[model samples]
Target: MTTEMSGADILIQALNDQGVEVVFGYPGGAVLPIYDALFNQQRIKHILVRQEGGAAHAAEGYARSTGKPGVVLVTSGPGATNAITGIADAMMDSIPMVVITGQVGTPLIGSDAFQECDTVGITRHVTKHNYLVKDPAKLGDIIHEAFHIATSGRPGPVVIDLPKDVQVATAPYRRTNTSALPHRGYKPAIKGDLTAIEQAIELLSKAERPMIYTGGGIINSGPAASMVLRELVKLTGAPVTSTLMGLGALPASSPQWLGMLGMHGTYEANMAMNQCDVMLCLGARFDDRVTGRLDAFSPHSKKIHVDIDRGSINKIVRVDVPIIGDVGRVLEDMVKLWKAREYQPRDLKPWWNTIKTWRDRNCLAYPASVESGEIVPQHAIRKLWEATHRQQPIITTEVGQHQMWAAQHFDFESPNKWLTSGGLGTMGYGLPAAIGAQLGNPKALVIDIAGEASIQMNIQEMGTATQYRLPVKVFILNNEYMGMVRQWQDLTYGGRYSSSYSDSLPDFVRLAEAYGWKGIRIERPDQLEQGIADMLAHDGPVMVDCMVAKMANCFPMIPSGASHTDMILDPAQVSGVMDDEAKALV
Candidate 1:
C-alpha cells in the first residue's frame, strides 16, 4: 500500500527506515518544515549545535568512532557553507557521512533569493556523490541512495540539497524493507584477483627484509580486518607500520608493530620502510607526508598495493603488484591461501636487530620535568595515556604538535578508539568530535586531547556538552602557540615568529565555568596526575588546561621535500633555515 505524505514527512520516514537514531544539526528558515517534521517524531533525536560547522565535525566524530555514517542537517547559504570544512575533512579521511542541507524553494535556487545558494554545485567536489531533489516523489529513493553511496566503497560525505518547495509538496511514499536503493553502475568490487594474492604471498615468502604498511582502510573494514591483519602479521613475521589515520588498527603491544611511519613517524618505522626488500601496502596511500621525497621512498622494495579504490593504487608511488578489491576480503583470501600451503614464518632476526638499534635512539624521549618545572608536551601526552589507557578512552585531537605528540605517545590497543583530523588537519575539529563520540558511546570515556590554540576554534561546543550532560573531557596542553606553525616558522623562516603566537588567549577555567563545565588548571608538574584524576572523577563535562614547555618541537621529523633517512632527530640537528623549494612542500 502506498501512503501519501509531504516530502518533509517522507524524508523523516526514510531516515527512520534507515535506522537513524541521532542527527547533528542547526535549524533555520529553509529547514523549518523539515525541523517541524523532526519535532513530531520521537525516534530520531536532533542535537542542536551552536554552529553549523560543529554539527558536521560532531557527525564526523560519531561516524569515525561508531563505524556508521554520520548524519547532518542544516539550513541553506551560510549553513551549508559552514559545513564545507567538515565535509572536506571527512572526504579526505574517507569517513562515511550524509549531509542534508535545506535550500530555498526550487524557483528561488538561482535567483539569489534570501538564503538560497548553489548548495549542490558548492558541495559537488567535497562529497563522494551528491543530489539535488526537484521532485518530491524521488525524495525517499534519493535519501536511501545517498546513505548507500556515503557508507560503501571508500566511504565519504554525501550531500542532499532539499528545496523548501519539495519539503512541502505531497507525494505517494512507499516504505521499503531495504535500506539501500540499488544502482547498477555503482557496484564496488569486494574480492581481489586470486592470482595477485598468490603473487603477493610468493614475494612476501622470499623477502629477507619485509615491511607491512597498513592504514585507515583496515580500520574502516571493521574489527574483523584488524583480527585478520594480526593473523597475517603472525604468518609473515614482518614488521608493521601504519599511517596517521591508521592508528589502532593493530595492537601497539604486538612485537611486530613498528609504530606510525611518515614525516613525524618513529625512527625505527621510517628506517624499516627505507630498507625493506618487500613492502606490502594495505589500504594506505603513499601520501607526501608518508613518502617524503617520492623517488627516495622505499626505493629498494617490490611494493604490493591493496586498496578498494582503484584510483588510490599507484596514485603517488607505483607498486609492482596492484590488487584492486576490499582490503578485508583480500586479506582473508591471502590468509587462507598462505595457511593452506602451511608456509613457515620467515627468519627476520637481522631485520629485528637493525630495527632495535633504531629504537635505542629513544626518538620519543622527552624531559619529564624541566628546570623551570614546565610540562613537556610529549611527557604530558604519555602521562595522559597512562591515566586513561586502562579505561580504553576514545581520544580525538585537533591538528598540530599536540596531535603528533598524542599519535606518537598514546598507544591504541583496539580500532575506533582514536579519532583525529588526519588529512585536512583542521584546527578546530577535536572538541565537537569529542561531543559526537561521547553521545554515540554514552558510557565510554571520550576525551579531546587538544592544544590551547586549536581548542579555542570550537570552544563554544562546551555548551553542547553541558546541555546534554555528557562527561566528555577536554585536556588542553597549553603552550600559548600554534605549535606546528611556530615550528615551521623556525625551520622555514629562520625563527622569526609571526602571527603564530597566541597572546590574546582566554582564561580557559573561567571559560569552562561560563559554559557550565567543570574546569581545572594544572601549572606545575606535580599537579598533572591529580588534575587528570579530578577530571576523570567528574560526573559531567570537564576541561583541563596543563601548561607545557613553549619552545618544544616534534622530532624524528623528515623535513619537507627530504627523504625518510634525512630526519632531524633533535633541535641540534636543524642546521639552518630551509630554502623556498622545501618550504613549498607540506
Candidate 2:
C-alpha cells in the first residue's frame, strides 16, 4: 500500500523500513525539515556529532564493525564539504556508507542562495553513486537504490542530495521490502567462472611454494568468508599473510599465519610473499603499500587473483588467472573441488622450512619496558593485549606508528574486530570509529589505540562518548610528536626536525575531566599496566596518556620505493640530531 506523505516523513519511513537503528549527524539550516522528522523518532536513535566529518567517520566505524551499511545525515555547503574527507576515506577503503545531505530548494539551487553549493558535483567523485532528487516520487526509490549500491559488490560510500523544497513536497512512500530497488546500470559479479576456479585449484596443487595474499575484502565479506579461507588454507597447507586491513581475517595464532604483510609487515611474511611460486591472491587488491617495486615482487610466481570487482583484476600487476566472485563462494568452491579430486599439495616442506628460518629473525622483538625505564610504545600495546586477555578485542586506530604497532602486537582472531583507515590513512579516524564500534557492540570493550598527534585530530568525539555513557577507552601513546613524520624526517630528510614536534600539547588528564571522563597519565613503564587496568575497569569513557620512549621508532620498515629485502630492521640504525648514537656513528 502506498501512502501520500511529505518527503521528510518518507525518508524517515524509508530509514525505519531499512532497519536503520541510529544515525550520526550534525544539523544545519538547510536540513531543518529532515531534523524535524528525526526529532521525536524512537525507532532510530540520532547521535549528534560535534562535526560533520566525525559523523561520517562514526558511521563508517559502525558499518565496518557491524557489516551493515552506515548512514550519515548532514546539511548543505560547509556541512557537506566537511564530510568529504570521510567520504573519500570510505571510498578508498571500500567501507559501505550512505551520506544524505541537504541542498537548497529546487528554485534556489543554481542561484547561489544562502548556504548553497554544488553538493552533487562536490561528492560525485568520492561516492560510488550520487543522487540529486528533483522529482518527489523518486526520493524514496533513490534512497533505497543508494543503500543497495553502497552495500553491493565492492562496498563504498554513496551520496543523496535532498533539496529543501523536496522535503516539504509530498511524495508517495513505498516500502523497500516489497519493491526491489531498480538498478540496471550496476551489476557486480558474485560467482566465479567454474573453469577459472578449477584452473586456480590446479595451479595451487602443483606449486611447491604457495602463499595466500589477502586484504580487507576478506574481512568485509563477513565471518563466513573467513571460515572458508581457513578451510582452504588447511587443505592446501600453505602459509597465509594479510594486508594491514586484513589483520583479523584469519587467526593471528594459526600456525600458517605470518604476521601482517607489507610496508611494516613481519620479515617472515614479506619474505614468503617475495619467494612464493604461486601467489593465491584473495579478496585483496595489490595496494602499493603491499606491493613495493611491483616488478620485483614475486617475479617467479604465477599469480591467481580472485576478487568480486572485475576492474581490480589486472589493474596493477597482471595475474595469470583472474577469478571474479565473492571470496566466500570462491574459497568454498576451491575447498570442495580439492576434496572431490582428492588433491594433494606439492611438497611445500622446503618453503615452510625457509619461512621458519625467517621467523627466527624475531623481526617483532622489542625490549620490555622493565629493561628500559621509559615506556616502550610496543610494550604498551602488548600490555593492553595482556590486560584485555582477548584474542579479539575490538580495536580502532588512528594512522601512524601506533596504528602499525597495534596491528603487530594485538591478536585479532576474527573480522570486524579491527578497524582503521587503511587506504586513506586518515588521522582522526579512531575515536569516532571507537564510538561507532561501541554503539554496534554495546557489551564489547572497545578501545581506540591512537598516537597523541593523531588522536588530537578528533579529540572532540570524547563528548559523544561521555554523553552516551559509553565505556569506550582512548589509549594514547603520547610521544609529544607526530612520530611517523618525525621518523621519516629523521631517516629520509637528515633529521631536520621541520615542524614534526607537537610542542605545548594540551594536558590530556585535565582535558578528559573537562569532557566528563576519567583520565590517567603514565610516564614510567611500571605505571603502564595499572593505568590501562584502571582505564578498562572504569565503567565510562577513560583516556590514558602513556608517555612512551621519546626516541623509539617503529621498525621492520620497508623504506619507501625499496624492495622487501631492503628494510631498515630496527631503531639502532636510525640516527638523529639529538641521538648520542648518531654522534657515535659520526
Candidate 3:
C-alpha cells in the first residue's frame, strides 16, 4: 500500500528530494502536464528562457559556478533537438546536468506522430546515460538515478525522455535513497595509491626543473582541491601553468604562476612546458591545443598524471607514473608523503631565469592606446579587468578572440568564478551563462566578455535578463568580424576572409533599449573608463558596444602542426598558406 501520485507530481517531488531549487526550461504541448504540476507547486522555480539552447547554457553556468547539478526541462521534438549544443558542451567540459525532455505518448513514440522523436537515441553519444520511461512507477527511481549519475564520477549531462501519457499516469511515489544509488559498478577512485604518490614525490624532489600542468579536473573537484594545489606548489616551489578551463585553480597573481598554456598561451608558459625536466599533470588530459605536435611535446620530461577517470590516463600522452584518483586526494597524499620524508627539491633558479627571459619577450604586447574613436580589444579587456578585479567579479565569455583576451587579461583569484566554453568552443555561451551566474550569485558582479558576432548567437537572452531583473553586463568587443575564423582564414587560407566579415549588424544599443535595459556605447579611448563605470553603476541589465579595431589578430599563435617553441608572436611573422594536411591538424 502506498500514496499514489501523478508522474508529473512524482517528478517534481523527486527533484525536490534531490535538492533542486531551480530549473531552466521552456514549456510546450507535450510538457503541459508537467508545467501544470510546476504551477501548482512553489518548491521548485522555473526560469522561462527564450530558447531551449539558452536554457541549457544557463543551467551549465549555474552548475559550473555552484558545483551543483544544473536542471533543465523542455518539450519534445524541436525543443529536445535545440538543446543538443548545450548538452554536448556539458559533455565536453564535464559539467553536471540533468535534462528532462518531453516525448510523444508511448504509442506515438514509434508511429512518427506529431512532435515525436527518438530523444534517447539522438542524445546517447552526448550524455553519460539516458532513459526513456514508459512506466510511471519506474520514473521516480530513474530521476533519482539520473541526478546521481550526473553528479557522480567525472560529472556530465544525463537525459531523461518522458512521454506525455507517462507524465499524466498515476503511480506509487516512493522516494529513492540518493546515497545508495543502484549503480554500484560506477564507483570512481577517490584516494590515490600511496606507493605511487611516494614515488611521484621522490621523482619531483630530485628534479632540477619541475613544472605543474593542471586543468579543469581540480576545479571540478571543488575549491578544497585548489587550496591543496596552492599548498603543494608552495612546498615544492615549482612553476605553474594551466589550461583555459583550469585558470582559477591557482591565483593568476601567484609568483609561481606562468599564465595559461596552449595555442594562444603565454610564451613563458609554453617555454617552461617545453623545457621542464619533470612535469606533473593534475586532472588534465593533454589536449591537442595544449600539446601542439604530439611527437615534439615535452620529449625529454618524465611525466606524471593524476586523474579520477582511468580512461583519461595515458589516453593521449603516456606518463611514467599514472596515479588514478581524485586530484585533491592525490595531491593531499603527495603533500603528506613529502612532509613525512622531509624531502627538499633541488635548486631551480636556473630554470626560473630561463623562464624570465621568455617572459621578457612580452608576446602579449599591443599598443595600449589607440587614437580617439578606435579601441584595441586586448586593451579593452585589460581595462575591464582593472575596473572589476577589485570586486572579484565572476566573468563569462563567448568563444572567439575575446575569450582568449579575457583569459590573458582577467586574473582569476579563485576557482568557480570564470566560466567559458573550453572543449567545445561554443559561441553564444557568454550572455546566457552570465544570466545564470548572476541569478546564482545575486550580489556578485557577473559580466560576459563577448565578441560582436558571437553575442548575436544568443542576444535574445537579454530579454530573459530583463524579465528576471538580473544586472548581468554584456561587454561586446565589437571587432566587426568572426575574429577567430578570420584569423584562421588569414593564416591557413591566404587571408581570404570569405564569410567571416560581420555584415548588416544591428544597433546593439537600440536593441538593449528595446529590451527594457540600459545601453552604453564607447567609441573612443577617453570614454572607456567612464563607460565601464556607468555600466557598473546601473542597477539593471546593461549592454556596452565597445568599438574595437577590425584587423588586429590574436598573437603568440602556434600554427597547426607547429611545436610549442614555434609560435608566431606578431602580425609580421604571419605569412604563407598551409596545405590541406596542415589545415586539419588544428
Candidate 4:
C-alpha cells in the first residue's frame, strides 16, 4: 500500500522510521510546511532554539551524549549558513548528525532568491555527505541515505537541503526499512586482519614497557571495543592513555589508565609514551595536540596502529604493523590469538614498577590555593566530578579554561559520557548543548560546565531548558574574563590583558532567576560541595555561579606557535627548575 504525502511529511516519516525521537531547529518561511506537518507529531519532540547555530550545537550535544544521530533543521540562506560552524564542529569531532535545511523553491534556484543559498556546495567540505532534494518523490530516499551516511563509519554531519516547492509538493511516500543509496567511500573493515593481529600479539608478548593510546573512534564504534581494549591492557599489564577525544574510552580511575596524553597531558603520561618500548595505538590519529613535535613523540616506541580508516594508517607516524579494520573486531581477534598462544610478556615487573614510580612522582599537579581567597577552576571541576562520579552523567562544556579544566580534572569513566567542542574550540556551546543533552537523556544527569563569558553568549537557552523542565545544571565559571586567552596574554604579551576582563558583567544568578530557574553563587571552596549537592537536588534547571580566580591559567600548556615539547609544566609556578625538568624529560 502507498500513501500520498507532502515532501515534508515523507521526510518526517522517514526520520520517524529511523527512530529519530527529537530534533533541534528554528522555523522560517521556507520551512513553514515542514513545521506545519510537525505540529501534530507527538512522538518527535522538536526543540525551538534561539538561533540556528544553537540548534546545530544542541544537535551535536545530543549526538555526542547519547551516541545517536543528532537531527537539526533550519530555514534557507542565512539560517543555513548560521549552522555551518556547528556542522563543521561536528565534522571535526566525528559526531553523527543529520542537518535538514529549507531552501527557496527549485524554480528560483539561481535568481538570487529570497532566503536561498547553495547550501549543498557550502556544506560539502564539512559534511560526510549531502543531498539537494529538488524532486519531492525522492525525499524519503534522500533522508534515509542522509541518516545512513551520518551514522556510518567515521560518522559525521550530513545535510539534506529541502526546496520549498518540494516540501509543498505531494508525492507517493513509502517508508522503506532500508536505505536506498550505497555508501562507496565508507567501507569500514568489519573483519580483523589475522596476520596483523598475530604480529601485534607477538610484539606485545615480548615488550617490557608497553602502552595503549586511544581516541574517539573507539567510542564511536561503541563500548564493546573499549571493553576489549581495557581487558587487553589489563591482561598485558600495560599502561593506557587517551587523547582529549578519547578521554571516556577507558575508566579514568583504572590503575592501567595513565590520564590524558598530549600538550596538556600529564608529565607521567607524556614521559611514559616517550619512554615506552611498544606503543599500541587504537583508533587514535596522532594529532598535533597529542604528538607535539612528530620527531619527539614516542621516539623510543615501536608503534602499531589499528584504525578503521586506511587513510589514517601511516598518515602521521610510521607504523610497524598497520591493522586496517574495526577496533572491536580486531581486538576480539587479538584476544582469541593471545588466548590460543598463551602469550604473556615475561619479567615485566621492573618496567611496571618504574612506570608506577613515574606516575606517582609526576601526577597531574593543579594549583591548590584554597586558602588564598581565590577560587580555582580545577577545584570546581573536581568537585563536580566528585558529585557525579560514574553516574553515567552527561557533562558538556564551553571553550577556554573551563573546557581545559573539565578535560583535565573531570574523571570520565566511559565512552559517550563527556561532550565538548574539541577541534572547533567553539565558545557559547555549553548551555545550548546541555539543553539538547538533557532532552536526549531525560533521566540522565546533564550538566553544562560553562564559562561566564561563554554562557552569556547563548544564555537565552536557559529559558528553553526551563520551558522543557530539563534538569540541566549549568555551572558558570565566573572569572569575569576570557580565562584562557587572558593567561596567554599574561605569559607572553607582557600582561597586556586586552578585552579579557570587564568589570561590567551580568549577574548570572539573577539571570537564571529571570529565566524561571533556580540559581546560586558559590564564592568559597567550602561551599562548593554543598552548592553542587543543592543544585543537583533541585527538581528543574539550576545554575551555579562558581566564582574563580581571574588570572588562573590551565597548566601543562603548549604555547601557541611553540612546539608541543615547549609546554609549561605549571602556569603559576613557572620556575626555571620545572621548565628545565620538562625540557630534560622531552
Name the candidate that leads on lDDT: 3
**What's the lDDT for residue 440 in model 3?**
80
- lDDT for model 4, please: 0.84
User: For candidate 4, lDDT tens digit of each residue in 1-586?
Assistant: 5778999888888989999999999999889999998996888889988889999999998988888999999999999999999999999889899999999999998898988899999999999889999888889887887887788767899999999999999989877655346766656576768888899999988898888899888888888878887878777888888988888888988988888888778766877888889999988888777887676777788899988778788888999999988787888888888889988766778887887777775546666757638778888888888888867688899998888888889988888878888777889888888988888888899888999888877787777887788888999898888887787667655677888885688887888899889989999888888899999889889999989887777877664433444567776545322243333333
Mark the 10 consecutive residues where model 4 has the least summed lDDT.
575-584
| lDDT tens per residue, model 3, 1-586 | 9989999999999999999988999999899999999999998979999999999999999999989989999999999998989999999999999999999999888999898889999999999899999999999999999998898778999999999999999999998997777686888788998888988999999999899999999999999999999999999999999999999999999999999999999998898899899999999999999999888998889999999889899899999999999899999989888888999888888988998899999988987765685798889998999998989899999999999989988899999999999999999999988988887889999999999999999888998999999999999999899999999999988989989999999999999999998989999888999999999999999999999988888988888999999989998998859977778888
Clashing pairs in 1: none
Error of 2 at 39 (Å): 1.7
Question: Which parts of model 4 are misplaced by more than 4 Å?
Answer: 177-180, 560-567, 572-586
TM-score of 4: 0.94
Candidate numbers, best lDDT first, in rank order: 3, 1, 2, 4
* TM per candidate: 0.99, 0.97, 0.99, 0.94
Q: After superposition, how far is residue 49 of candidate 1 from its true place, in Å?
A: 0.4
- What TM value does model 3 have? 0.99
Cα lDDT tens digits for candidate 1, 1-586:
5778999999999999888988999999999999999999899989999898999999999999999889999999999999999999999999999999999999887998998889899999999999999999999888888888898888999999999999999998876544345687787778999999999999998899999999999998888998999999999999999999999988999998989999999999999999999999999989898999888998899999999999998799989999988899999999999999887767889989999999998887776686448888888888889999999999999999999999999999999999999889999999999999998999999999999999988888888898888899999999999999999888888888989999989999988988889899999888888898899899899989889999999987999999999988999888658878888877
User: How many pairs of residues in model 3 come into backbone collision?
Assistant: 0
The whole-model lDDT of each prediction reads 0.92, 0.89, 0.92, 0.84
TM-score of candidate 2 versus the correct structure, residues matched by position: 0.97
Q: What does candidate 2's lDDT look like per residue over 190-209, in tens digits?
A: 88999999999999999999
Clashing pairs in 3: none
